[model samples]
Target: MHINPYGEDPVRFAVELAVDPPSSAADLVARCRAAGVTDVTGREVDLDDVRRFLDEWLGVVDAPDEAARADRLNALLAAASAYPRLTNHAGDGWHLHYRDPDLPLAGVLRALISVGTALHLAGRGMHRLGRCAVAECRRPFADVSRTGRQRYCSPACANRDAVRRHRARVS
Candidate 1:
């Protein structure tokens, strides 16, 4: 569709989903709506499915190494029920859609998430995604930095980590 910086949006949405899953169907729909997921069905099952999807998706994000990463992601792709297709929705023009109607909620997510993650890594840089540098917070992130060297989840986290490191060095 519009591709509103597809590389960034999908990765960011994936990371966000991984960090804190939505509490309810409305919350899930709202979060997805904010992330450009148009036409959310506003159903409780969708939220539950997405929660499951995110937990599995986080495993993809947290895989220890590249090979492990591929293994986890490959499992998802293999299990996905939807075949890749080109379609457009809402006001967006033509783009890829890796799903078909009537797909189960989890299956739908497996397709969308797998395809989206593939596009994000291939189109963007493979190194664009990572975990936060803060030791206490293992949250994952998509590095959309212009310099391509972002190591922290947020400035606050960075600052706190820096202070911790400085204190450690001084001690």
Candidate 2:
């Protein structure tokens, strides 16, 4: 199956930022670059913009139901999306972009994350985005597993919960 390129990675990137926000503008830009973001010029407002966007995205993740999630995401999609365009920079294969050209780092992130998240939720299940089930660890997690049954943020959390249950049962 041809998985959508814009789906998984962008949601993962959003989760990473929401988990541990960048300490500085440089750190944010560096993280973006590490995530294969292109055309980042390191503008000062990028940090604030990205933080604001992440906050809004968290609202989507924390939505009470699928309809609410779709509402929040639709708002983001309306705010962030632009006309689609095709580009082939650096001789790479041409790809469609849903953002305008010459946008700043934050703008790029907003477009990518919003559109990618929409595609993910629409293609996958609407309940795919969620927080960890562990009581002490409410970290956000994107359900990327093939079966779409991810409840914890990581295997460690699942194991921890299992051990806790085992201990409770033994006692």
Candidate 3:
């Protein structure tokens, strides 16, 4: 069965990109492919454009409250101008696309990330996306945990914080 592309994967990819953006168009294309986005069509990608888009996306992550976050995301969705359509572009099987045909890489990413983030937030919880609670590494993350209590970006950060707390308690 074809998994919905407009789901956790794209949100996770957005977090990954925001945390450590690609350095070049080739790197972006490769990373997209690695993230299972095979339809890398349309105009040649501009690295600067992609970076700028990602910065705008981070606004959604860093918004102060649910309303603010929704407002930021709505702006992105409006900018995407995406409409749902069925496509089997790679002959994989029929699936849904939320973008026009042959949009540039940046446009495609904008639609994918915006729509995916909306789906994730609405499906999971509005608080599902945020920066890591660890003070030193405030990286963006999409909380895919079953319990929905992910605070740190990775286990290492969580463990480090836990150990620090333990030492403070001992002291």
Candidate 4:
């Protein structure tokens, strides 16, 4: 079966990029490729735009409450973006692409990330994406868990958190 390309990877890409944004278009593409971003568009100038866009995205994440979340996300959608379209890159059958052609890297990312995030958070659960529970690990994680109680980022973090709690109780 053809797994959805816009699944875990794109959401993870957003977290990775948001956590530590790349400095160049090549860097963006390279990092994305490393993170499992298959199909892509844009180059150097596009990368610069992507960096700027990420800064704005971070602000949304930092927003205080649900009202602010909607405001920030809506602001992001209203600014220099577009609706979803159909594409069939490499004749791989049609799928919805939420971007225009040849957009600079930032524009492409804004759509990909926004749409990918929407799909991920909605499909998975609103609480899916979040910071790891381990104190020192500030990494973001997209919870692909079958159960919705995923508070920590990974098994390591979950174990570490449980251990910390146990140690504190014993002490």
User: What does candidate 1's lDDT look like per residue over 132-170, in tens digits?
Assistant: 888888678877788889888888899999999899999
Worst 10 residues of 3 by lDDT: 41-50
TM accuracy, model 4:
0.79
Itemize residue pairs with steric clashes in candidate 3: none
* Top candidate by TM-score: 3
Rank ordering of all candidates by TM-score, starting from the highest: 3, 2, 1, 4
- Residue-level lDDT of model 4, residues 1-171, one tens digit each, is 345666577777777787777876677778866765555543435665677777776665556664665577678767745776777764768777667767665666787777666667667766666667686985767677899677776788889889989999999
Candidate 1 segments exceeding 4 Å error: 4-6, 42-44, 89-92, 104-106
TM for candidate 3 is 0.96
TM-score, per-candidate, Cα-based: 0.82, 0.93, 0.96, 0.79
Q: In model 3, how large is the Cα lDDT of residue 9?
A: 94
The digit string of per-residue lDDT tens for model 3 on 17-64 reads 988899888899999999998988546798887888899989999999
Model 2, position 62, has a per-residue lDDT of 98
**Per-residue lDDT for 78 in model 2?**
94
Clashes of each: 0, 0, 0, 2
Candidate that beats the other on TM-score, 2 or 3, i.e. the better one: 3
Evaluate residue 154 in candidate 1 and report its C-alpha lDDT on the 0 to 100 scale. 87
Q: Model 2, 72-119: lDDT tens per residue? A: 999999999898887765356778888887778788889999999999
Q: Superposing all C-alpha atoms, what RMSD in Å does each candidate have to the true structure?
A: 2.7, 2.1, 1.1, 2.8
